[model samples]
Target: MTRPWEILTAATVAGSGLLAGVFFAFSAFVMSGLRRLPEQDGSAAMRSLNVTAQRPPLMIALFGVSVLCVVVIVRAIAGWPRPGAVWLLAGAIVTLVGAVGVTAAINVPLNNRLDAGTVLWSQFLAAWEPANHARTILCLLGCALLSVGTIRWH
Candidate 1:
């Protein structure tokens, strides 16, 4: 009895969860460990990390998942009688804006500044970590919502 919307909603839940785990790793361990490194090493590491993170595969996941979230929202709305449609829509929008959008709008610009030597370590962390944390929470929230929605009426 699994329908197209069911499959798509399940995929959205998985995608959101996977991406959230990545961000959670950064906020929880990677950045803190980077802070413990020597100033020069830390700065160099961050720069390198940012560059490497933009690899095609990772970029695809980061962006592709966001796009899928939008598709899920659209589908959810179009077939409004689906039990968890509203939750799916809310989760998609939240993840799109709070996680993907924040990363693109805020974190990317801050990374650019760090790349250009316009900001120092303390400045970089202060600005970057908070936004990263926010995205992590949002992604996790979205994942939870989607998970619940996926199972609620299935």
Candidate 2:
């Protein structure tokens, strides 16, 4: 039978991986596709996207993963014998600070500016894409760390 920590660690890894994939999709295709459109169209599309992205599924993935990471940290610390606790904790921190923090600080604000028609497409994409890339990297790193933690623990 699987232990509780094992299950929690699995959740952490899976959630982080899911978020990383989402970020990667934005960087790989979504942004690229937006780039091909006229400036007005692209900005309008992105503004719409910002609103649409606040829906349940994406919200769950973005916020839920961070919550999962916290829970994993608690579980890992409580069971101090776990060899991978440190890595799990590190993963949690990375996701919280990099993915969530950056999103809240950089992307959301940029989106708001775009929605208000205060930002140009070049400016929006320039700032937004690089920050998103940072988010992608962090989420991927968190996934990798959590996977390692899971393996070491099990």
- The models' CA-based lDDT, in order, is 0.85, 0.86
Candidate 2 per-residue lDDT over residues 81-114, each given as its tens digit: 8787787777888877766999999999999989
lDDT of 1 by residue, 104-154 (tens): 899999999999999998999999999999999999999988777676645
Q: How close is candidate 2 to the true structure, as a TM-score?
A: 0.93
Q: How do all models score by TM-score?
A: 0.93, 0.93
Error of 2 at 132 (Å): 0.6
